[model samples]
Target: MKTTFQHVNYYWDKKKEKDLKNDQIELFLYRSNILGKDLRITNYGGGNTSCKTIEKDPLTNEEVEVMWVKGSGGDIGTLTRQGIAGLYTKRLRDLKKVYKGLHDEDRMVSLFNHCIYDLNSKAPSIDTPLHGLLPFKHIDHLHPDALIAIAAAKDGEKIVKEIWGDTMGWVPWQRPGFDLALQLEKCLNDNPGIRGIVLGSHGLFTWGDTSYECYINSLEVIETASEYIHQKIKKNNTVFGGEKIQSLSKKERLEKAALLAPVLRGLCSSENQMIGHFTDNDAVMEFINSNDLLRLAPMGTSCPDHFLRTKIQPLVLDLETNEDISNTGDIVKKLTPSFEKYRQEYKEYYEQCKHKNSPAMRDPNPVIIIYPGIGMFSFAKNKQTARVASEFYINAINVMKGAEAISEYTSLPRQEAFDIEYWLLEEAKLQRMPKEKPLSRKIALVTGAGGGIGKAIADKLVKEGANVIFADIVENRLREATKSYNKDIGSYILCDVTKEEDIKNALNKTCLDYGGIDIVIHSAGLAISNPIEQTSREDWDTLQNVLVKGQFELIKQAVSVMRKQQLGGNIVSIASKNGLVSGPNNVGYGTAKAAQQHMVRLLAAELAKDKIRVNTVNPDGVIIGSKIWEGDWAEGRAKTYGIDVKDLPAHYAKRNLLNEIIYPEDIANGVFALVAILHKSTGNSINVDGGMASAFVR
Candidate 1:
C-alpha cells in the first residue's frame, strides 16, 4: 500500500503520431501492468481498470468519446491495447434506458455490444458498468485482501467510514450488475466530494481525472484501511503464537505434514489424481494451527472475486479421535468416510440451489482442504492453479485473523456463493476455454526423462494434457529438463529407476499424487557397445540392471497399483531396434533390450485380463537430441558402420526403405499413439525407425 508508483517503468513514445485514444490506452496498459504486478493489490484477473477517451466512429466519421475498459479474458499483467474494448460513452450512458425495460442479461449484453465504439468484438469486463456509470476519465477497482479484511467484517460499513472519514462512499453488497452500477452512480453523485468507494463484502474503488490520481487514491485509502485494521487487531489481540503452545522444529513439522500429504492427496482424487506437499511459513502455520481456525475457516472467501477461484466452503479435516492426527494409517482410513461425507454435504448444497436454468454444478470435490495441524492444501486440476488457490486462501487466513480479532468474520452466504459459482457470464467464459488436449486428464510417469527419448516423451505427454513426472538419477538434469517444460503441468522426481526401492517409491508417489496412474512410460535404458570378449562383468551388469531389470521394476510397480485401484492403465517401454536385429559388438545392451521386448509381450498377455494395455516402441538410430548417442557411443557405432560419427544417422536411414532418419520425437509419437489412440491394440511393437528392414516385426 505504500506509494512505490514513482519507480514503475514502461516504454512508450509521445512523439509517435496517433490519436489521443492511443495515448490513453498506452498509459492504461503500463499502469495495468504496474497494478497487476503485486498480488496484494490485485490478483490474476480479479480486478479491472478503465479510461474515457475519444475514438473515431468509422461509420459516422465523427470523433466520439468512449469508455475503454479492461476486456474479458485479459490479464492486466500482460495486457495489450487489443485487450481493451472501446465502448461509446454516450451510448453506454444511454443504456440506463435499455436496462430499465429489459431484464434478460443476454439481451442486455447484445445492447452493450451495440454500444461498442468500433467493431472490436472483445467483450468488456463484467464490472464495466461500474466504470461507465461513474463520471471519471480514469478508474480502478481492486480486491486487495487488506481492504477485504475490513470490508468483510460485521459492521464493515461503519468501520470503513471510521477509517476513510467522509472521503469514501459505501455500497452495500449488491451483485455486480446494471442495477448495481446505477446505485454506485447515485452514491457518487450524492457524496459530491468522495474520492473512493468501498463495496461491502466486495472491494475498493477509486477514480480521478488522471491515472495517477485514481491509482494513488486506491493506495492511500487501502493503506489507511490496513493501518486501521492492524491497529484494531493489535489492541484486542489474543496472539496465536506468543507464549502459547510448544514450538516444533521445521524438520519435525515437515515430517508430520509429509505423513498426512499422501492420505489427503488420495482422498481428494477423482478421475485425475491431485499432487500436493506441505507448504508452511510462520504465517500459515501460526494461522492454521491457531485456535480461531474452527470459527474462522468455514465462513468462506473474504470477497466474491475469490469465489471463482476458491469454492463456497473448505473441507475441514474431521480427525475424530486425537490419535488419528498422529497415526498415518489411521488418518488414511479416516479420510475415506470423511471425504464421502464432505461430498454428500456438497451434493445436498448443490441440489438445494440448482434450478432448471442453472449451469451444471462443478465436481463436488473440495478445492480447499483445511488441515488443522500443518496448513491448508488447495486442490486444482493442475499445479499452477493449486498454487494459486493456496496463495488466495493464505491471504484469506490472515484476513480472517484480523476480522476475528476485531469483530466477527462474515462473508456472503451460501446462496450468494452459489450465484457467483454458477454465474452465467462466468460459466460462458469457462465454456469458451479452448478444448483440452487428447490426454488432458490422464496422469503419466516417465523415467530417464533428463534428456533424449525420455525427455521427448515427457514433453509430448505434458503437451497432450497429461501431468508427467520426469524422473532420473541425475537431479540437476531432471530439474533442468522440467524447468524448460510448463511447470504447471510437469514435475521432476530424482531417483535411479534401476533401484527396486526407488521404483517402488516413484510408483507410490504417482498413486498418492495423482490418485491412480492412467499411463506409465518406461523409457530409461542404457547402451554399452562392447564385444563379448572385451565386456567385463561390471559393464554387463550395469546394462542389464538398467535396461532389463529397470523396465521390469517400473512396470511391475505400476501394474500393482493400477490393479489395486481397479483403474486399468497403459504401459510403454522403449526397446531398441538393435534388440530385434543382430548388430556387431552388441552383447550386453542388445540382449537386455531383447529381454525387455519379450517381457512386454508376456506382461501384455498377463495384464490384459486386468485391462492394462502394454506395448513397446522399437526405434532405430534415433540420434537427434540424444545424450546417450553423443560422444563415445556415437564414435563406437560409427566405427562399426565404417563411417564418420556425424554420418551415423544418415547411414541408418540409407539402409531403411523410407530413407528418413528417425528422431527421439518420432519415438514419442508412437508411444502417445499406443496410450491415447491405439486403445484396442496391445502386446504390440510399433517401429518408429522409418521402416527398418531388419527390425520390421509383424
Candidate 2:
C-alpha cells in the first residue's frame, strides 16, 4: 500500500541510487545518509544503519557474509566507508555460545573485535549485536522523535499495538547489549511477519532484504506513527496543559537572554568553565511557557542519546510571566539558591546510585537551564557541544509533546539512567578523549578583524581553541574573512567601533552567540600622517574618534559583559610605538595612539580588582599586510624619511636596534602572548616593532 507522510520527507532519490548501481555498500551509505539528513529521523551522532554483504575474505580469498554498520560515535549523515565497522556475520552470531548471560553483556562487546572482517574497520558500537543477530540483509536502528514519542508514553505498548497492530512488534526497555539483541530476535520470531519493532523507552528497528527496502520501511513506520500522534494532538484541547505564560517579543526575549546567559555561564563554570548556547525558537518557548513545565521538565528525557547530551533534566527557574529584565542582580539573587540546590541534588543522586566500581562524580552543574517566558540555555565544554545540546533538548520537547498528546509521557527510570550515565565503558570513552587546548571555552571579540593585524589575531585565537567574533565596519571584508572559519569557532559582525550603539550591539551578540566574552582585542585603527601645520581640525578629530574614542567605547561595553560572567577577562589594545617616540608630521595620529596606550594602563588598574587584565602591544613600521600602510600614511612617512615608499621597509628596519622588519603576524603573536602566555603580566606593554630604542616603554 502506498502511504504519504506529513511529518517526514521522502529523501530517496532514484537518480542518486542509480549511480550506486549494484554496489550494495554504496546503496547502504546512500540510505543511511538520506535518513540521517532529517532530524525528524534521528539526531546528530544518534542512529546506526547496517547492511550484510558477501565479500571476499582478506586472508583466505573466500566469499563470506560480512556486516558493515555505522561504528561507535559516528554520525550516519556524515558516515564514510572508514566509519563503518566490518564484522564477519557468522562469527558474530557464533558469539551467543560464549555469552554467559545478561550479567555478562558488556564482556560480549570485547569478543566482537575477534569477528573483524576488515583489519582497518572502525570499532563497533554497543548496538552491534542488535544488527548482527537479526536475520536480514539490511537493518535500520533509529531514534525518530515521532517513534520515540510512542516508545516513551506510559501506554507505549498499547499505543504501538493500536498503530501498527501485529505488523509491528514491541519489546520492553533493555539496555543495548547481547540481552536486548536476544530479546529482539525473540520478538521477531513471535510476531511472524512483522515489518518492524518499537524498543520501549528507546527507539525503533526496521529491516528488509535490500537497502532501499529497509529505508522505505523505516520511513513508513515513523511517518505512520507521526500521523497518528498528530491526529491525536489535533483532537486534544491543550498541550502541556496549555500555555501558562505569554512569550515575550522576540527582541525582548533576546534582550533578557543576553542579560542572563553570562550569569548562568559564570555559575555553571564553578567546576570547569563552560561555553553556552541560547535558543528562543518556537519549540523551546512553547515548552518553557507551558503550564506543565514545572511538572514535565523534572521528569527528564527518556532517550539515552538525548539525556547524555542534555543531562538528566534541565534546571528550571521559578519566575513570573512578567519577570523584571532591567538588571541581572535580582535575577542572580534568585537563581543562586536554585543553582546551589541543583548541585546538592546532583550530589545526592551520585551518592544514592553509586556502585562500588562506579567512576567518581563529575561536574554537578546542569547542562541546560530553563527560564520561564524566556528560552533555554545549554552549556558544554565547547561551542559545537553546547549548540548540539540545545538542539537535542528541542527534540526531547517534541517527543514530550507527541507523547503527552496521547498518553502521559514517561521518563527513563532514574536508576537505569544512572547506570548508562556512569557506565564504565562511557567513563573509559570520556578518558580517551584528547585534552582541551589552552584557550578552549574562551570567547573573544576582535575589532578590525576583516584583514591585516586584526584578522591575524582572530585566526590565532581560533587556532588555540577560542570562539572568536570578527567585528569590522566593512561587510564584504568581514564576509570574506569569516567564510574560511567554521561557524562554531568563528563568526563576524558589522561594528563601526566609533559608534557606541554598534559596540553595544556587537558585545550583546557576542554574549548571545558564544555565552560570554573572555578576551577583547582592540585592533580597529586608522592613521593620518601630516605635520601640525597641515593637519586640519576635521582630520585630527577623525583620528581621535576612531583610534582613541573607538577603543574607549568597545572596552566600556565589553567590560560590562565580562563582569557579569565574573570570569576574569583579558583586554589587549593594539597601540603604536608612535605613541611613545616623538616624530614629525605625526601629531594627530601620534596623540591618538598615546591616548590608546594610557587608556590600557588606566583600565588595568581599575579593572584589576575584577581580575580583568588590560595590556598593550605596540608595533612600529609594520609595512607588509597592514591596512594602515596602504595609502597616504605610507607615502607621508616615506616622504618624511626621504625614502621611496618601495624602500620604506628597509629604511624602517635599519632605524630599529634589532634591524628587523615587523609584519602583521608579529603583531598578532604579540597579542597572543599577552592574552594566552602572559597571564600574570597584565598592565605591561610588549613591542612588536623589532626593537626600536626610542620607542621602548621604560
The candidate maximizing TM-score is 2
lDDT of 1 at 93: 83
Top of the candidates by lDDT: 2
Q: What lDDT tens digits, residue by residue, belong to model 2 across residues 83-201?
A: 99999999999998899997797788889999998888998989999999899999999999999999999999999999888899999998888989999999999988999999998
Question: What RMSD does model 2 have?
Answer: 1.6
Per-prediction TM-score, please? 0.89, 0.97
Task: Candidate 2: list runs displaced more than 4 Å.
Answer: 1-4
Tens-digit per-residue lDDT, 102-148, candidate 1: 24554566577778875664787677788898989989888777777
